[model samples]
Target chain A: SQTIHQWPATLVQPVGSPLSLECTVEGTSNPNLYWYRQAAGRGLQLLFYSVGIGQISSEVPQNLSASRPQDRQFILSSKKLLLSDSGFYLCAWSVSSGLYNEQFFGPGTRLTVL
Target chain B: SQQGEEDPQALSIQEGENATMNCSYKTSINNLQWYRQNSGRGLVHLILIRSNEREKHSGRLRVTLDTSKKSSSLLITASRAADTASYFCATDESGGSYIPTFGRGTSLIVHP
Candidate 1:
């Protein structure tokens, strides 16, 4: 039983506008996708990660960008938006290469770059 | 410049008392996770100690690891109030490069 979904839980862009956040994983099937960010007090900021479909692995480097295309879909992009980019946006999942690789999160997305 | 470092950034227990948090990291690790956030939501995988293993629990949470002095500690028993939140300590790096390196958390405030 695996389930991780994220959407526009809350967002308010402006700085330069243009950002899209979306993550999906139901019942798991080649999971292993992540993209964390929580700056306000700092901590938890691993940008992007994926282990399949197109494969992406960026740790940190500004504006933000990530994509996984299929295999459970995972995306988090941005073309502008910067006010430090805002924060609190997670979306994780594990169990793709197996072996006790704990990591399951979702239900987050609170951007506010104005 | 953070491979993990959480030590008394904030804490104010009271619900049932018993909340300890401490973490220190620098290099050489194979595992050391513990997360739980509930202020902005997300993050909730609390317990993963394996640097050759030192301690690990779940139900009431109890983790301890000290690969020499890399440090790690998280003990929250009897505490409630939804367990307040904010507690992180990650560091998985033993060459395999599994990706995990977070710190700067420890804001538990369970005062009911």
Candidate 2:
């Protein structure tokens, strides 16, 4: 079965510090990957999605960026973090861009910027 | 918005009782899906109902979709304390739009 993995299950970062979160998928090939940020008691906000390597689409303009360095490896980075950047980060993968877009998520990363 | 907004933001009930949650969206969709999230964890896909279909069942979950009303409901029968979690609904439009919007989920607490 396919599974997604996210790193740093919990993180505490100081303001102005750099941020890096990684996500990888196993048992699947050429899967579509997405990055989402969710506030406490709030829905998810799409930050970035990639259909293939070196291709990324950003949804919201903010202090975060995403990169697909490999087929199944996605990275979320920021040069400097902001207080508003604190939230639960989720990584998800879908079958592809066409039919059966059902998404499977990875264990999230909770970041607290102090 | 393309998101499905849930009603009764929070619900509490006793175990073995029936729990129902409603979700409404603003546009046409190919399908609607329900997900469950335990506290501080990832979401698990619970059930999915297609626009062409009115109802679907899996285990103890019953999902109904009303395309005309652009609404969907999730009914959980014989609820248990282990079923306590946040429930979210998401809509997938007919077109090829890949971005999915999700509303603040409905929090459910089942006391044993």
Candidate 3:
């Protein structure tokens, strides 16, 4: 069975501060990783997705960025945070196959930028 | 732009009653899926119905897809309080791309 893990289940950051959220998957290799953000009472916004290491596709151009350092390790970072950056960050992984594989999600990180 | 949209932003029903939510989408899709999210937690995939299929069942969940109308519905039978959660529908476009576009989701509350 494959499992996903995210760190800093909850985070409080000040404006203009740096941000780093990590996600890793076990029991799977070369999986598709994605980063998503959900604002209060809003739908999820896809921030970034990576099909392989060192490859990242950004959906919405914003202050946040994502990187896949290893086959199963993904990181979301920001040089300077904004108030609008506050939201629930989620990490997901799916099988690297054809279209239409169900994605598995992690516990998620609740980030609050004050 | 959101590819899918869920109807009735919120719904409340008594336990044991049936709860049904609808989802509409734009563009052609290879498949549509339903997910459940508990308060302040990650989402769990509930069921997936391919575009070629009309309906599918998994335990208490029954999902129907109308490709002609570009819509889908999720019916939960004999709902329990534990079923209170936000339900979202995602669509995988017909193209080879595997990315799924998500909807705003419908919040369902099962009163005990």
lDDT of the structure predicted as candidate 3: 0.94
Classified by CAPRI criteria, candidate 2 counts as medium
Model 1, position B56: C-alpha lDDT score: 84
Q: Could you report the DockQ of all the candidates, in the order they appear?
A: 0.28, 0.70, 0.78
What's model 2's overall lDDT? 0.90
lDDT of each: 0.87, 0.90, 0.94
For all predicted structures, in order, the TM-scores are: 0.34, 0.97, 0.99
Tens digit per residue, CA lDDT, model 2, B1-112: 4379998899999999999999999888887889888999988888777789999999999999999999999999999999999999988777846455676899999999
Segments in model 1 whose C-alpha atoms lie over 4 Å from true places: A1-11, A14-46, A49-56, A59-77, A80-87, A90-109, A112-114, B1-14, B17-29, B36-38, B41-50, B56-74, B78-83, B86-94, B101-111
Better of 1 and 3 by lDDT: 3
Tell me the tens digit of each residue's lDDT in model 3 across B39-73: 99998999988889999999999999999999999
Best by DockQ: 3
| Tens digit of per-residue lDDT, candidate 1, span A1-114 | 888999989999899989999999999688889888888888887888888988998877777898898999899999988898898898988887644567888988999998
* Candidate 3 structure, TM-score to reference: 0.99
Ranking by lDDT: 3, 2, 1
Candidate with maximal TM-score: 3
Q: How many pairs in model 2 have backbone atoms within 3 A of each other, for residues 3 or more apart or on separate chains, i.e. clashes?
A: 0
